[model samples]
Target: MKEIAQSENIEQFSLKNYIYIDKTEYIYNLIKKYDRVFFSRPRRFGKSLTINTIGTLFEKGVEPYFKGTWIYDKWTQNTCPVLHLSFLKFSVSDLDNFKRDFCNEILKFAKTNNITDFTDDKEPKVLIGNIFSAMPEDMHIVLLIDEYDCQLTANINNKELYEKFRLFIREFYAVLKGEKHIRFMALTGVTRLKDVSIFSVGSDIKDLSYDHAYSQMIGFTREEIKKFYIDYLKLGISYEKHIKTDCVTDNDIEEFLDRMAEHYDSYCFDEIYENKVFSTYSVNCFLQSISQNQRVIFGDYWYEAGGIPSILKNYMESHEIEIDKFQTSEISINYDDFMNPTSLPYMNENVLMCQTGYLTLKSEIKPPRRIKLGSANREVKAALNSLLSQKFFNPDALDSFYDADSILEKGSVEEIIEHLNKVLATIPYDKYPVENESILRALLLMYLSGLRCDVRSEQHNFKGSSDLLVNFKTRRVIIELKFSKDGKDTDTLLKAAQEQIRRREYGIEKLGDRELLQIAAVFDGSPNMRKITEFKQIG
Candidate 1:
């Protein structure tokens, strides 16, 4: 396959010459039902572009950009005046500056329409009133606000400051309900602050964040990928010359699709099973990386663009949440949590995760229902692992655990035990308090996670549940753990654990022409004086 170079300007903002995704149909349908709408999505999920598209669609003449798009023939003949305000173009730090920035946007739009009635000195609400009153009654204003919650969300650390900004925004947008000349209005933000004054306005605003009708509005669908970028993908996959197959078949293409889906797809905004969409930002990054270097690299494009929001990092640290808890997929959260305009006084982890796009809606019932949460994709999982490792675990300790994993794959019990002890020694005193048999198992699971192993905790069998089972490429490692509050006979506990694994025949079914490595870990003493007592293995 001949290599094709993708545009390096994928990250640049330009509505012209853009790969116009078919969202016009959705927008047309949306405007017909709701005059005021609030759409919330994660940052860089193409909210800005969508806003621009709406604005351009209402322009006087059908621009060349919409020549062949869905809206070309279906759009209204008379274009209306568009008043677009972007919160990102301001250097706002406080409520005053935020108001000033909004007023500036109003003044700029007024100048565009040849109306000189607005001033920067006026309050945001007064300026909004002046602009709306000055517009011709025949030319209804198309109001579009992008990054509407930027000021409040950016200052989430300052409770008083966030509240002030939220109040100002609410009061400013409160005019939307009574504005008579406005034809349509849409607001976009990273999160919805339901309790905030803005959304409490009497306007009947529809939230499209989790609505199934617009699930694919922000991201690329699988079929869209194959239709738009088949050539680019073919060239990109050919660069993976390391695949051991003699000749690539149709299965290889499917495998490539699976790989992309694992890293970037599976973002479900709605409870519906078929509503998932890939992150458009990550997809472009992936294609751009592969095209530029001719190699597949799933580097931290989204996470690195902007690391986990500082608000989330502080929350996690304050709560002292273990990193492994992210793997727990059955967390429950209320649907209203994401709609509130103000930050919750005491936010739930699942709610925070879902709103910030780390966890997405997995399944749900209708009204008064609890929604299930799970990781958005492997890209997010890898980002969390990187963040957790850097924040909690020492580099040397992680290295030792990884080295121990390699040794356990083929080495004897004594060799693996020595390496694992080194890893355990790196645990600080603070981590000691959380130490227990479960923590030990979690530690092993975390270490094994670095490798491409299929690890299961509390794996069930005929006898009982095994503590941990790690299936490597060629071998199976079955581990059981026991804990003691005092420095007692942990040796016997280790022996008993090994015997339990043997009795259950944990690895017998899949041990054909491969090795079954059984190991036992025993912890002794209380939290104040705790350490691993002994490590045993059954060959």
Candidate 2:
């Protein structure tokens, strides 16, 4: 019944009654295995908490805070001086301010540890070197750097500024390369920038980004969720008005988890693709919502909590990124290519998108080893579609597009078609020319994704693939699309589409307990003037 805490600080876990999913076992093993580690994951994946945990272990010695954690008894009670630096804490608006602020932070760390006789140099590299030189030979410090690539990611759009910051941070990190006083070092960031000295200079630092063992280090595994969140899940089920009973069944609990997984799970980080963890922050937010509202609402917690990452937003605005391609088609990249350091301005958009959490590792390919990436989950897919719709549709059109949700729930074929046509009319024809069936399907899928329902395209069954399938609370709509460039008879095209759906038996296996509504839609006119000519329920 206690509130779930959202603080990034590990010390606050107990103070704030936070349900801390114990990943200390994994973290303890990581510390024992690697002396230097560089971990790159998308934002809000708990990189800061991971950093704070490491800092807590080394600097504060696991005690009252980590009583129930795995590392509490395993770790020695000996504490060491820690230099914890988070780039997020610094002002990165300009070069001088960044340098001065970072230098002051280093000085503050040095002063905390009682290291003296350091120069007041504005250069971060000089300050770090001074601290290293000033430290006693017997005392080795633990270094945990959080958001190491923050400045670079923030200035990615500005090539000149980005390069300057990159060079400076590279030099600053390079100081730690061969420093004997550094007992252990860990750097966490959203990206692994190319030419950073920390990776290339001295002894190799292990990158655990793609390591299978550490994939679930920062996120909530299914087992963890089942063990930790069962009470909240049961409470949510109890509050459901439709259940109408005090006793909850196992199927009820599992069905709730299934919905949660659909919206929040399936973020794969390793090459093996065996371990998929739910978004940690999103899971917490969902549980918090259930606790506060006493009702279960599977909302877009991750995307809603942190809107499009700034780096991704800037990349999208500046680059010619085909937003539809990523969602509509299969995407794969070589393992080596994906792991390699990405440079700015000329960075691979797909790689960047994967790094920023827009896409996640879907599966692994052998022979010529590669990784397939796709939308992490339903929440991400819907968020991406909503973003795409905003880019292509005006305010009025967006309102009309969202209104389709209510129209869809009513199961009115005519109303749904009218709303779809209104949304379609607002598409910028100059940029997105609907020339063929595939384009029309993609556009329709984009709009349908915005609706508060489960929308999927090219859903394959035994017979064939359905163009689009939408699942409402009680109804399943199977849509078959047909398009003609020449002035073909709309009625004929509509009938053909209907026959294809019936002949193929699309979504027949999926009609478990819900009412099925099969519709055939035909689009007529040229690329610029394409509009839905007819839509009819294929009863």
Candidate 3:
């Protein structure tokens, strides 16, 4: 922790300290194998850092900067001309301004490399060609572009503007189609447009976004955490008031890792699903915060760091995306279709969510190129729930929502029922249509997820499934919901729900010495009334 300072400049920090893990061998192998590579990952997932690392390696050979890295002894190639471009701060509001600025950026890079055979051309495509032509014939150049799709994603809502920009980008990138002097090239972005010229043209760029070999290249793996940040983990545990310092054991550290994984880990990018990594940005932020404050705190650091991508926020608002559907059921889509989206304007909401990091692959690649997607982790789920609740429900009313952790720990069944009723009353009538028990369960799950508890829907056992289950510390609440649009009485519905929970033996095996609370709730699903009518404890 002392070696790592809080700095936004990752390049400088990485070069100066041992805090950064070395992945030079992996990247070097990729460069040696592929001439052109395209990668896609969510925002703030170290794409920029990866680009910079490659740029530095090619521009300055691994003498002083990468002295002890894996590639130091094996980098046999001489340093060559490197052209690095980053679109993270590009202004794309106007086409004319964008063109002028883009050309200037290329010219700036060209001038730094002492390639001065450039005409005063405003066209970016011409400037790029001139730069390439001016380079020495024997020396091949390495090109690294970060956030290549930033312009298109920014203007996705404006169809006319987006099309115009897309045409310009396609033509501009088409200049690299037959560049024989390119030693290696790589482009990284949040989404990979299917028909874009960068992929559709003659350029043989391999998309390594879902390649299992590189899935753990950017993010921090669990083993990496244990190897690099074990001291910080112990520090966090020491800061925990409930854990005594003298009695700290290996089990305490394992439990702390589990809690941290719930909030920040479990992001599966590839189909294999064998290796899941935590968001690098989120893990760094958490460690930095705890180090500064001397306390253990788990927050939505990733979501809070970048809020939500404007593209995703706009898409969710414009489309009638059923947020509950993703929570209630497994969302499976073709792997090819999900990876190579045709266009951003008409892209599927699930694809957009997956690209933007709200959702991630939940299962391995199944038959027929199908994969299941869900919320990346608990932090992501809580962030989405908070966003939707703020958008639809009254903010002030949300403050009145029960303290979920406290109530689940010590409150009685009647208190839990009252909490559920209060939470349901905040939902607007038209926003949520309680048509069936599943819908009701999904809605409750969505709202309850925002609290500090492990809330799940459709908990299955050997016999059947329970509607909802909420676990907080030492207490677990298993809820069975019954919805009735016809003329079914609350008493009958409650009895049926209780019978189902008992007959299914829900929570019997899972309840290992912890106190369990079973609830039976009946909701009135009529058009005029969509609230939980009555609820009581079944066991």
Candidate 4:
């Protein structure tokens, strides 16, 4: 076996030696045409790495350092100053100080270029404008901004400050977007904020984020992985450990490669990537592992270094929804938009889902054009499901969600809820975990609603959702759950819920399936005053 263990040659392993695919070539092309360029990416996904690579190409003092780089051989154009700023280190405690933070980073970038004259300026944007103007006219100064979305992302719900800070950013970036003095500008971030103004006001900017041609630019393709791993495979590091067992052969590389691809692939550009993407971050992390002679990094690459499941969970819990609902629904308005009026911006859940990697675009036709996008491929879906299920949601409350047998099982399903109701009937529902327990119960009911039933949230039931419906089951149930912050009374809440359910004809659609649909009301913690009622769905 050809051994390329990490201890054997740790010093020689550099991305420069590894063939950089995708976005790299296109970025160089853009550099040739424009002076200032901006790009964005999520955290730990190689945003800094891309900038460092660009640094090797154009940093004023690092010119001779590009000796073996592909860019060194092909980039014969005149040199320009590269202004790179990574704002990951910047703290955004409040939006009010975002401009100050941004301006300070701009100062740091300027200082790196030895421009320290106006570091103390109060009007930092003006100073920034001046710095752009000060760039030598003969050479284009490349402006690379990483994590441009950090400030805004750090405070998603602070509408007033976010909008104010966004405007500050708009005015600052406008200097580069203007006709004179600026070369090409590239800005990058995790996702887009509709009111960020960068997308709307930037005149000539083109988003290559979703461009298929540049798709492989930022990541390792299935083909790249096979080639890169050929050496590792020969090293006795058993390809079977990662791709297959020793029984595999060269002829099996195709099937083995396909398996490797599925576990790690996900598309993110309007879901343009689908399962085609190889989680660049994950692949790199794997390569790091393989080079270190660690064959099994983790079960699947998607669960490890690729995407942060916790971040997704934070979004889900904050929104009070499940991961499955996100996979199935479209998000037109962010929860921030719901919390703050000015933050209202239409978000096509599909597009946002695609951009963020949960969904991928499936099809597009030119003549009779229509775009079809859907959840990531089966492999990614499985990985995501596994990752999300393990998240902390009252860890001690429920060890697991309903399984296959628990679901779609007639007597079993009813018994599961009935068991839950009996348990709930005895407990105090006005406490901390009470809402979660009740919500957990609701989630089980919602899961059952599936193809046969439909559900929505409203405020008629009490302080929480008015009615939740499940139409497919033999008897549809109109469920409502509410709790009081201070008092323990749930009698009124239960009555309101039952009345609302009846008035809205919650089980009207289930009439054909059964003569009666269960109608129950709980005052949550209304002493022993809780009420349970049943009614017929028929006329």
TM-score of each: 0.82, 0.93, 0.89, 0.62
Per-model C-alpha RMSD = 4.4, 2.5, 3.2, 11.4
Query: On lDDT, who's better, 2 or 4?
Result: 2
RMSD, candidate 3, Å: 3.2
lDDT of 2: 0.80
In model 3, where is the ten-residue run with the lowest total lDDT?
1-10
- Per-residue C-alpha lDDT of model 1 across residues 378-419, encoded as one tens digit per residue: 677656555554455565645555564568787777776666
Pick the winner on lDDT between candidates 1 and 2: 2
Superior by lDDT: candidate 1 or candidate 4: 1
Predicted model with the maximum lDDT: 2
TM match of model 1 to true structure: 0.82
**lDDT of each residue in 1-539, candidate 2, tens digit only:** 55677778999997677788898999889988988999888888899998998998888887778988878889974789888888998876699998888888888888888999766688889878987887788979888989988888887788888889888877776787768998999999988766666655354688888788898887888789878888887888888845533577888888878888989998888767788989888888888888798788888877788777778777766777665577655587776567665575667777887787778887863436776788888887887776666666664745655666667767488877777788888877787667778777877787778554688899999889999888877778888988878757878898899999989987777588887888898888665447887888887
The digit string of per-residue lDDT tens for model 3 on 157-239 reads 78888897888878877888769888889999988786577766355888888788888887888778777777788778888
